[model samples]
Target: MTRDHPADFEEIARRFSHLWQALNEGSPGTRKILVDRVRDALDRGEARLRDADCDIVANSFVLEALINDGAATRVYRARHRDLGTFHAIKMPRPDHADDPVLRKLMLREAEIGMGLRHSHIAATQTVLRLSDGRPALVTEWIGSRLAELLQQRPLSLGEITSVMTSVLSGLEAIHAAGFVHCDLSPLNLLADGDLSRLKIADFGIALKRGSRHSQFDLAFAGQPDFASPEQLAGEPLDERSDLYAAGLLLSLLLSRCHEESDGTKTLKALTNHLSQQDVQDRPENARAALHLLGGSPKRPVDA
Candidate 1:
């Protein structure tokens, strides 16, 4: 169907099911025809649901574009039909959509995010259920990921300071809310152009303070380089665990800046203190780490 004359839900589903069956059991000629039909449906921007229940989320949001196709989830830049506001809708990959373990993880991330409200924390607006009974998280739209920005250009000392301060501030709030942001890598941080607006995103593996890690947590362990020593050991974690990751995140920023001034040296020292192998060796918390950077917890670094 053409974009102006799109296929209805029923027709789309029928084509999708036939394609699935063809791939598995149909003759070669039939499989080729089914493939072409499905491709045409997608090219026309027609909605295709793997299961009947998938329509709830598909119909609610007008997916503007695919933002990121990650290993487990696909994030879309979507506009909510009723609200008329843009958001990042995170849905599990089709293969993972029906997995109970992934559903629980997404639910847990939404639960942790809903309680957090900070300028440096990306808000989780709400969770929508897919037609197949899986959960999708609706989050504030952030156009840039820190990882992408780092690849584009080197940041100035002021930019690094600003970004690190924002991250620590976010961690402070997360810890105060009784949770540790188990994931704090560059990929999980969001920022706008010029490093002016930065926020922490992705709490898929965040754990409550003093709470034991679940089996699902193991599968989603954050980036290896950013994971704390205690986290790698599967030991009990507290705010300090997140502090370690924050320190590494700062180091990642500093590595790209290529400056060796006194200010840079100071930040490097702070990074060392934050990433100490022993939890006690690091700053007591994010607040203390901020102080070591010669700044107040409430005031961000001058950008």
Candidate 2:
């Protein structure tokens, strides 16, 4: 019976089964073992998908196909048997679906996404358990990413402000909901119809307001060069971290060239305000940055 099916798929299933065992064991060593096994599984799976003439994500709402394969798991855009629409299906690398850590990450992202309700934030539709016993967080598909837009050309001032407004609005909602978006970067930001509309994506590494911050600095995860000192030092963060990221977004917006000459000055001002390397330095948060941008719409008086 198995011979009728592909040998590669069979091998992948066997490896996945082994990985499941290792993850269920729930030890650091077991996790490491599972990680390697999952990598092999993904490679095989990708080949099978290609052979089947399938895209990374399934086109039909009824079929399940791999959409996003993140560091820890593979997600499929699938139609639920009951719900009858396309939704995100998350599982812990086929092998580690039951792993507590992976399970927690999935739930955490879903909760954060649901809590943050804004046009600029990816909306969480629902979270449910799959028939195969894996967890899924269904969300509105925001389509392609900001990276695609910026690839063509840099955004204009008005365009950037419009996008930032949405992003900041979303951040405000996120902060109000009592969570910190530990990950914020161009890749995580998505564009809808045009550059003016932006949506922040990927909440996997987010931290709740009162939770103890991670020891390893995640600031580097977003963009180390753009990170504020507090993030670089792994200190407890507030709205200031988001401001630092916004400043980078601001720099990208205002700079005439991709690498603006005045970028250093702007970053310096923002870093001083945020990092407080000097005791006398005044702290400027995202709100303050927005205030600065507020005046951008007005033309400077001829002097």
Best by lDDT: 1
Per-residue lDDT tens digits of candidate 2, residues 179-276?
77867777778766665557877787677654434533333344575565666667666666766666566555555333333433444354345444
Cα-lDDT of candidate 1: 0.81
What are the runs in model 2 whose C-alpha is more than 4 Å off? 1-65, 78-90, 215-226, 253-285, 298-303
Q: After TM-score superposition, what is the CA distance of residue 226 in candidate 1 from its true location, in Å?
A: 0.7
**Local lDDT at 9 for model 2:** 85
Residue 180 of model 2 has an lDDT of 70
Please list the Cα RMSD from the true structure of every candidate, rounded to 1 decimal place: 11.5, 14.0
Whole-model lDDT, model 2: 0.62
- Screening candidate 1 with a backbone cut-off below 3 angstroms (N, C-alpha, C), the clashing residue pairs are 53-131, 54-131
For candidate 2, the 10 contiguous residues with the lowest summed lDDT are 53-62
